[model samples]
Structure formats: C-alpha cells, structure tokens
Target: MSTNKEMKTATASTLNQHVHPFDQLTGDEIIQTAAIVRQAKPEVDLVFNTITLKEPNKQVMLSYLGWDTSKPRITKVEREALVVILEKVTMKCYEAIVSLTHNTLKSWTYMPDVQPMLTMDDMFEVEELVLKDEKVIQECRELGITDMSCVFNDPWAIARHVSHPGREKRLMQALMYMRTCEEDNQYAHPLDFVPIIDLGLKKVIAIERIKPRDSKYSRPTIPLQQHNFLPEFVGEENYRKDVKPIIIQQPQGVSFTVKGNEIDWQKWNLRISMNYREGLVLHNISYQDGPEKRPLFYRISLSEMVVPYADTNTPHHRKHAFDVGEYGLGLCTNSLQLGCDCLGSIYYFDAVFNDHNGQPVEIPSAVCMHEEDYGILMKHTDYRNGRAHTIRSRRLVISQIVTVANYDYGLYYYFYQDGTFEYEVKATGELNTHVLAEDESAAGMGTIVAPQINAQYHQHFFTMRIDPMIDGQNNSVQQVDTYTLPYPTGHPKNPFGNGFTSDYTILKDTKEGQQNACYETQRFWKIVNTDRIHPYSKTPVGWKISSGHTAPFFAKDDSLVAERAGFAKKTLWVTPYDENQMFAGGFYCNQSGGDDTVEVWANREVQDIQQKDIVLWYTFGITHLPRVEDFPIMPVEYCGFTIKPCNFFIANPALDVPPTNKKINHSVLAHENSSKGEGPKSCCSTKL
Candidate 1:
C-alpha cells in the first residue's frame, strides 16, 4: 500500500515557533512522518500502529525549559517521531525513530517475536469476520441465536493461555454476546461460546464453548429477557423528579489562561497532553509562590492498569486485560459533552492518533478542564462578637473518560488551592455477565446479579508513574509509618500506653524502595529534596504520597495473570529517573510472556537511589464483588491517591485567598414559599 498523500510543508521558522517540546504530534506532522518512513522503506509494505512524538532528551528539554541553570538555554530541539510498524506480508514488528525536523530516518530496529497493541480497525475487522464465518453462525444457531443481526462480540487481548493451540500466531478471542434488539445492552445477555481469531490470517482459528452442547453445565439458549439502561427502554417518567436545575455560569469567563497546551490557573501552572497509551498526561507541573515558581513534578500519568477476572473456568481464566498497553486509553476515549461531562466555563483539548493505514485520526474534545467549588478552604469563628472568617475552596480538574468493553473508566486529575494533587479513577458501565445453567454455582467465582446472569469478581489495579521535581531534581523517598509505643505500662517511654511515634526510613537502594502499604501503621511515603532544607522545620522539603484502597495480587503466583501483571503485585516502587523506563508493564504487553516489567527493572541491581533523580511507581486498586443492583448499569466506583505538601511550603499556601463574600457568591436560602431568603447580610466581618 503506497501512502502518497500530499501534505503541506511548513516553513522551518514557523514550525519551530509553534511546536512545544511536549505537545502531541500534529496531523500534518503525522502525515509527514508516514511519508518519511515510506520513502526509507519502498520495497516493503508497512502498516502503521503508532506514530507519536518522541520526546526530546529529558536533560536537554529541561535546559530548554530553564530548569537546568548550569547549562545554557537550548533553543532549537529536534522533533522526532517514534513509529511502530508491522510488515503486512511477514507479520514482523519494527520500531523506527524518524526525525521530523530533518525529514530523515534515524534508526529502525526489528522487534523479535512480539505483537503490538490491537488497533480500532483490528478489533472491528475481527468482529466482522466472526459474524460472517459459517462455523460461528452454526455454533450460534445451536445456542438459539437464529438471527445473526443481533449478535455482538468484544475483542479482547489473549494474554497467555498456552493450553489452547496456535500459540505462535497473533490472536484475539471474541467474547460472544447477543442483544434482543439493536439498542439493547449485549452484556446483560452474554452467549456461551467464544471464537478465537488469528489476526494475520483474518480467520476464525478455533471456537471454545463453556461446555459441550450436550453437557448440563452449558446453557443452550441466549437469555431473551431485556435488561437495558437507555432512556427509550426505561421510560422517561421513571427518571428522577426531584433533581432541580443547577445553573453554573461564569459571567467573567474562566479563571484560567490557556496558551497552547500549557495552563495557568490561580497560582497553579501545568501542561496537559494526550497520547495513545496513557490518555491524558500532565507535564512540567509547578506552583507560583509570589514571584518564585516552585516545581513539583516533571511528569505524571496513569502509566498502566489491568482488570483481572477471577473465574477459574477454561476460557474465562484468560480474562485479564492490560487496558493501557493492549487497547490504548487514548484510542478508546469518548468525546465529552458540555453540560454532562463537565459544567461551568470549560476548556477542551483534542488528541491525534494514527490508523492502521497510516492516516491521522482525531478525537475532538478528548480532554475536559474546568474549576469547581469544593465547599470551604478555611474557616474561623470568634464567640465574643459572633464574627466569622471563611474562605471558599475551589479546584482545577483535568479529566477524560474511556470505554473499554464492559467498563467505562473516568480518569480525573485535580489541583486544589492548598497545593495538593489528586488522581481519581471512576469505574462505571455494564458488568461482564454470563448466563448460568441449572445447578451451576457461582459461589466462589462470581455473583449472580440477575435471575440467571452471573457477573464475575474482578479487580482493577492502576499503576501511576510520578516523576517528582520536589524543590529540585535531586530527591529521595522516606517511608514513614506511625506506630504505637511497644514499651510496658511502667516503662518510661510509654507510661500512658497512648504514645505513638513515626518511624522514618530512607530508601537507599532499589531493593529497599519496593514497599507496601501498611494500613495498621498508617504508612505513607514522602518524596523529599534533601538539598533544600526548611529553615523553620529543619527538615527536607517534601511531598507525601497517600494512597486509598489497595489489594494484594489475588491470582496464584504461577498463574498467567500474575506472571504478566507483576506491577500490581507491589504497592510502591522507586527507581532513578530513566526516560526509557516510563511504563511499569514494559513497552509491549499485549501478548507479553511476562518479561521486562517494572518488577524486573527494580530488582536488576542494588544501585543507590538516594538523593538522586527518581520516579515513584504506585499501584493501587479495588476488589469488586458484583452487586444485584449493578446489573443493567453499574454506579460509579471511586478509587484514587493524593499528593500533599509535607514541609515543602512554609505555611498554608492558600492563606492569602480572599474570604467568602455574599456579593460574589449570590447564594439564597430555600424556603417553603415562593420567595427566597437573602444570604447573610454581614459580609465585612468575614474578610480575611
């Protein structure tokens, strides 16, 4: 396939002035990149999987950003594209680095015995092929699926279930589903059979069922009962009636300034970008303290995540999904609506990715940004004069939502006025269900949410990659845990037996940095800059990482899910900053045999990691047991981690904020009558 599409070339001066070091590759840039790669390899037909910006070297980019004072400010940084291509004939993968700045190929290396992530076209093509195959039609007909128009399937990455045949081929297993109508929810009526397809040959290689057609364990017919959440099916009158109209408007416009991808809101400043794998990413995060800009993190993102189901059945045991690596979050992102996804004055950003044929695909409004009122920041009251001082709290939120098969994940990044950063994942969608046969027990494996539909137990583990710039580049991690005194009642240390102390341990090496969350001890890790001393506290300036709900790897040690998802086995991992070591689950994890992951990288050596440029890999998750109410649609489940200042700031950073004023707030008290009560009359007393 010849990619001879014409692209308008920009002048060198215009290109250098517009493109930032961290911006996503533009559409024109992507077209130019594919053309350059085709010119270098004219003899071979290449299919493009990923064509993204190859970020400049960290130190050099830092110098350009003026972070490195020792080196002169570098002006012109080369724009490079990291392209992954597949040979259509041989089915071999290759990683190429093309210089978009010079319009030349830099290097190309063939990847041995590996498969790239499944693209949107790959998923759609397999579904089409399976629906047309005679074998699949006959199998479905036997299961009472007479009309194939209502048949549906979800293409999932085959992690490592070697018990089945065809281990050498690039494959995907389609979990079959059937809907009563076109708009019906398919997950609520899952079929019993699964079709395995060889992506290279474009054919259904094998078919696996829950049990033999004559066996008692398998259900012979698809569940015809309708379970749907759409408005047309649920009826409009069934919706909530008490939800009043809440209008959020900014007459003076947004409080933030957007110049390209960088945003400056209140005292916080950061740049946001999106790619195919990690979705939304924050870069060059910092805060403006009066005239000084205090850098907190160089980059932060949801590096990788896995959803492993707990059903031990043959085909069901291979249900683990590497959402980030296998099917990129960016590719699955939804175009958010205005008043639904985000309210108030909002700013949106678009994402650019490549299709199978090396063409640019843009998902417009892929990111949503806005400010929200969060109750109160600080409050004080004096009894003497009945005077009060209160300051309203507000936060800046950058978020995106992605739908991966049965789950819709809403990823949000929040920045508060008190110099705190939060990352939250909201999981809500249709739960993956299967129709149960008579006398079949889902006791240990899953939960029967409906009459006969079973939703399996599962866990969603997320690995967040945090590269801190605390006060400077040189940083260290200290594991801090609170413990009660172990002395006797008569001893001098614990005379009251209520005494508690904190144990601080500086993680000196990679081995020592692999720590776990201890809830009994109230454990947390602090990323500190030893070189920067807080004069008042006489300690290192630092930020603390506080995680929410966490769980241990539930899969057995020798299981395929456990072997491939090694990053979820530990809660925290610290390693010296290396640009190439970004993902916790390695570069390619679609059909990975569980090698070259974060677990391997952290244990490669006992190198000293103290007082150096370091990155923190935090893995946190939730163990989900499907509920009866989670059938048609599941409510949002929240899990996240927070980063707060721990002596990094001399005092409360938000102390300078103006007090809450009735004139600006314009809030009214509700009353039984038509008339509304005016807000508090006294406003001057609440001034800060």
Candidate 2:
C-alpha cells in the first residue's frame, strides 16, 4: 500500500514540473516539433481555373445579432506576389472559415472541421465542374479569350460606389453583386475573369459563383399563444370561527430505555394536558359560493409539559436537567369533502423556572416542528354524468419553531401531504433531583395509555385527552398516546414489531414482505459515549467516545443484574443494505441499487404500522402551526411516540449451525446436475 508521505511527494513533484524551468523547456520542444505534427496531419488538394466575373442572378445577406447596417465601412486591398499572397491569405482565410464552421457543426458533426460548410447543391455543382474541367477551357477558347488576369476586390467597395453604406451594407452588397445578375435571369459566370500572376507561376483553383435560390426564401417564425392551468377558485374563501383557548399542564417526569434490538424509547408524560382550548373564533368565506356559502374555520391552542432523558444512565456529576417539548395538531372534519381544505399554525413559548435552590432564573427553551402542508384528495365519478369527472384539492399548512437558549430560537416551514414536522426545544431550568432511577419503580411512573400495549402493561397504562374546537364548534379532540415500559429479550428479529428484518433474512428473501423474524426487530443507534468497567460491576473506571456503534434495545434486560449489564450481550438486526450484505445481492444488482433501501424499508414500516395495528391513537395530520409568540422567533418541538413490546418474541432453541464457506463452495458442484445455465449454487445444499 502507498503511504501518505509518498502520495504527497508524487503530487508535489508533478505540480513542480508545470511551474518551473521544465515548463519553458516543454514549450520549446512543442515549437521544434511543429513540422513533425504538420506532417502527421491529413491533407487535401483541388485544381481550378480563372473565369470571367459576372453579376449574380440572386443574392442573400446575413447579419449578426447586434450589427448595424447604417454605418460606413472601409475595405483594404493588399498587393503581393501571387504565390506568396495565395499561400498566406488562403491559409489564414481557410483557418478562420474552418474554425467558424467547425464550432457551428460541433452541435451535430462527428468528424470535426473536415466537414464542409457548403450544402448538397454546392457539392453537386463542384462535382459537375470537376467533370467539365477541360470543357470550360474549350468554351473560353471559342469565346476568343487568351490573356488571363486575376482580380481581388472587396465587394464592400463596389457597394460604396453604387449606394451609401447606410443604404446598402457591405454584406448585402457582396451578396447582391457576386451572387446574382441585374438584367439576366442567370447566375454570375466566374469564368469571364482572367487569372493574374505577380511573383511566381502557379495554376489557380477554379472560381465558381453561387446565389441563394429565390424560391427558398423564408421569414423566421415566432410563437404567439399563452396557457394557464391554476385553479380559478383559490384564495376566495373567508374562514372565521370562535374557538376556546387551551391551558397547558406540565408532566411529572420522563424516561428512556432500550428494548430488544429495537428503538430506544424516549417517553414523556403530561398529566393534565388539554387537547384544545375553548372560546376560539374562526371565519369562513368562499369566493365561488359568495359570502353565504363560505367555509367555517376554527382554532384551538394548548400547552403541555416537556421532558428529555438519556437512554443510558445520567452522569453522576451532571449540574443541569433538560426538558424537551413537541407540538402536534389533530384534525376532525365533517365536510363531505373529507376535510380536505385545512389551515393551522402552532406557537411555542418557554416556561419560567427556578433552580434547585429555588432561585428564579430565566431559562431559554426552543421548539421546532416540520412545517408543511398536509391533505388528502379523493376522486369519484360525478352522479350527474357518469362520464364527467370531478376533483377537489385540499391544502394544509404547518410551521415549526425551536428555542435553544433563553434567547436563541429558530423556526422552519414545509408543505406536503401527510407529512409530520419535528423540532427540538430546550428547558429554562435544571431539575434539582435526578428524575431517572436505576430501579424498576422508575419504569412505569408516567406511562400513557396506548391500546396496542395494553396486553403487556395491563392497568399500568395511563391516558390523557385534550379537546380542540373545529370550525367554532366542539368537534375535534387530541389524544396524548403513550405506551407501557417494554421488556427486553435479546432477539434480533421483530424488535419493535415494526416489520423491519435483519440483514440475514433480507439476503434470503429476494421478494418483498417475506422477511424472517430474526431480521425484523433490529435497530441502530449512535453510541454517544461509553464507560468501561469490570464484568458484572456498575462502577466505571475508563471512558471513551463510541461514535458509530449501534444501540438496538428499547427496554432493560431483567435477566441481567446491574453488574452483568456491563457484559450484557446485545444483538442488532442488520438491514440487508448494510455493508456486510454487499455481495449477497450479486455484483450487478448491488451496483445499481445500494443501501438507500434500508431507510425506505423503515419508512414503509412506520406507515404500515400506523394504518393497521395502531388505530386507537388518533393521528394528527402532520403540521407545524405558527403562533403569535413565534413571530420574532420560534422554538423547536421534539415530537415522537413510543411502542412497547407485546407477544413479540419466542423462546430460544438449540443452536443450528450454518454451512461453512468451504462446504458452500462444494455444494455448487454437488448441485450442478439440477442447475441450469450459470445459476449460483446454494450453500445450504451441503450435507450436515
């Protein structure tokens, strides 16, 4: 392997050559090699003769984007030996013309500058001239023309003699005189001009004059139509209704735990939480239906206590406590349109607190939530006409706020259908006592009722409900849904019953929804910090930052004592997209699609679980509402839910060893008789 120092040295040397004496030497060598380069390039040759100059029958003029045709222009003429003049002038002119043509042709051509600018007609005319090379000489002999003289005059000079440059531009004059004839309806004949030699003897290339065809003339085309597709009835509604104000209650405490290979539970409890306040007002006005048929609107405001905890034990030397709060909005619509049209905002404020010594101090708190529009659209056949179609578009808006310190705050907004917003807010003061205890009593203190976990925690589950008004009526309700503390068993699959499976099972099931239980329960977490201790001990003597290691449990393991917890064996379900599964999908499939699918599977599981198993908890359509207090700044709302373990595992059985690498290789040969084409062999085909 190459070392870092060696790589740096090589890079430095390569760069040094370009900036020092080596660069000058390289330039000299390039100049010395010009002849060799030219010899290596391809060449073409053509023969031609001088002809009389006649007025063209037709002409065309071209102009640049900003060129003015009213300005006078001067044309210079140079007199030099024929041989030297032709060599120098033709080389420069051909280079410039070829460069311009090549740049334009790059949009389509593949052979670079070799392609000619003339069209098919020009090519056909040139071919005819080549075939009649001797015939043109015979015609001149018949006309009694003997002496030959070459003429070199700018077309612009001729234009000046006939009309001012303001009337006839140089380009227009050249096109008219050289390309067409004034009286005769025939193209100009170049054979009428004689060739002249000044310094050397050399046969001249044939000169041919061409004109733009009159029938081919056309004016540029332009588009002249406009189209708009926005709905005509938007922003025409007046929504106003009265709703009651909400009073928030603080929760007693919060807790955190890591269960069996699943998510780490960060639970909060707001004891007397109100879903929605009363006496709020809303107004509704519709543009299409006038003032009478306007839609009704309502608003409710509520506050809840916030608490935050670490999954692992809190540090003994910690000086401050932290509380985190989140915001959510619930929608219940009676509109036959499925409550599709809705708008709401949430505002957050920090709580004043006293330190452990009862001294009042202004604490800073922040709240943030995903701010986006959320709605649902339904399409059905129109009863009036089975063939006619009717559609409705509903809109929901959410705004989030986050407050970090006493004065530090942030806010964000988003718009989407069925999307949730979350932000983090800080607490004003620290708690005097450590809220979390390393004992079982602390496990179920603030449990919120979650029907799905009732079977496991039974009567231990707690519940709270907040009622918020809808359209100025007591029509909506919000529920603070929480689950009981989970129990941990070191099973890799079905960690939280969220449908995610392990990498091992993912490799086995190529199709969707066929994952094994072992892979389903695994979860990943970042280990912020760690303390090493003697096996079976609770005291830590060493510390290290564990950045990327996985934490896969959401509950405490009862079987392991506090001491054994240090040595506890934890298993995480690895998703198939993990690095270890790279080769499992074969080379081609792996290259096209990678580990991004792991997040997709997790999102799918979240949606599926919300729809099927957890119906008792009412889902607040995703929103981040803006409040008056959130104007100058907003706070972050940390919003998330919890799930407790229930009938999620089976007892372990005797170990069943898997085939070894060598055995897997040999199995391919043994199964060759049953295989077709180049199919891969199964490692399990080997005999035990």
What do the candidate models score in CA lDDT, each in turn?
0.86, 0.19
Candidate 2 residue 682 C-alpha distance from true site, Å: 53
lDDT of 2 by residue, 293-412 (tens): 211111111111112122222121111111011111111101111112111222221112111121222212112111121222223455675432222222222222222221221212
The TM-score of candidate 1 is 0.95
Worst 10 residues of 2 by lDDT: 453-462
Model 2 deviation from native, Cα RMSD in Å: 39.9
lDDT of 1 by residue, 1-688 (tens): 2112211222212344677888989888889999999999997689898998898898997898888999679998999999999888467899999998899999989888788888898899988999999999998888777799989999999887575433357889999998888899998788888888888788998888886222476454566788888999999999999999877756666688877788899889898888889999999998998789999999999999999999887788899999999999999999888778878777778788999778889887789888899988888788898777778899999999999988999999999999988999999998988767755668577898876688999999999999999878889999999988889776898887789899889999999989889989989999999999999989899999988778888999888888888899899999998888988888888888778688888999887889999999999999999898888899999999999999988799999877766566656666534244554654436443
| RMSD, one per candidate, in order | 5.0, 39.9
Which stretches in model 1 have alpha-carbon errors above 4 Å? 1-17, 163-168, 212-218, 672-679, 682-688
Candidate 2 overall lDDT versus native: 0.19
TM-score each candidate. 0.95, 0.16
Instruction: Give model 2's TM-score versus the native structure.
Output: 0.16
